[model samples]
Target: MNESWMNEVSARLASLAAANPARDFEKNARGLLSSAFARLDLVTREEFDVQSQVLARAREKLAALEARVAELEATAAGRVK
Candidate 1:
């Protein structure tokens, strides 16, 4: 039904692209995009997620350390009173 129609259209398009200059244009476009992307600083989703988790853990540890320091300072001030 609809699936067979799509398959036939895809086959026709593939045949036309193979025999046409469109194939070379598509290749050149992909190469240009890849070159541009390579020139930019970028991270994969997995790397970004890992770094985000690391930063979150560091923040939590920093908060705990700050609380500990505040408690120690208060205890010292009470003794000095």
Candidate 2:
């Protein structure tokens, strides 16, 4: 939110751009932009890790449901025999 902080970031990015002569300028610029945006408080790696674990559990539950559906279908077809 502070203009001075933004200016400082801009200056640092400019320095990075000048120093990295062998890298892609656009990619480096985008990375700098991302870093600046990330300066604001955001989710930490630990929080993201927790969410990833939750998603994995949900996916496992979904797979079990799909397998159960297949088994039910098989049972229903057999009953029609």
Candidate 3:
């Protein structure tokens, strides 16, 4: 019986706290921060990760092309000699 009473009291306290001004302040602060963050240019982690992968692939291709060009230049030089 005592445990049940304590639980009920705790629940009422929680319900009251939820309606308190501090809760409203917290909600308003969260909204303000969300609005400010939304106004800035930002990419999601998924987008940043995808773009990083794309850049890595592009770098690999460029390196392969450079190596191929160097190999061709060497072959051309050997032929001239």
Strongest candidate by TM-score = 1
Clashing pairs in 3: none
The most accurate candidate by lDDT is 2
Instruction: Please estimate how well model 3 matches the true structure, expressed as its whole-model Cα lDDT.
Output: 0.76
lDDT of 3 by residue, 1-81 (tens): 357755755565566557768877567556655665575667899999999999999999999999999999999999999
Worst 10-residue lDDT window for candidate 3 reads 8-17
TM-scores for all candidates: the values are 0.72, 0.51, 0.62
Worst 10 residues of 2 by lDDT: 19-28
Provide the global lDDT of candidate 2 against the true structure: 0.87
Winner of 1 and 3 under TM-score: 1
By TM-score, the better pick of 2 and 3 is 3
Error of 1 at 25 (Å): 1.0
The sequence of per-residue lDDT tens digits that candidate 1 reaches over residues 1-81 is 357755755565576667769867577556655665565668899999999999999999999999999999999999999
Model 1 lDDT-worst window of ten: 1-10
Residue ranges of candidate 2 with Cα displaced over 4 Å: 1-35, 38-42
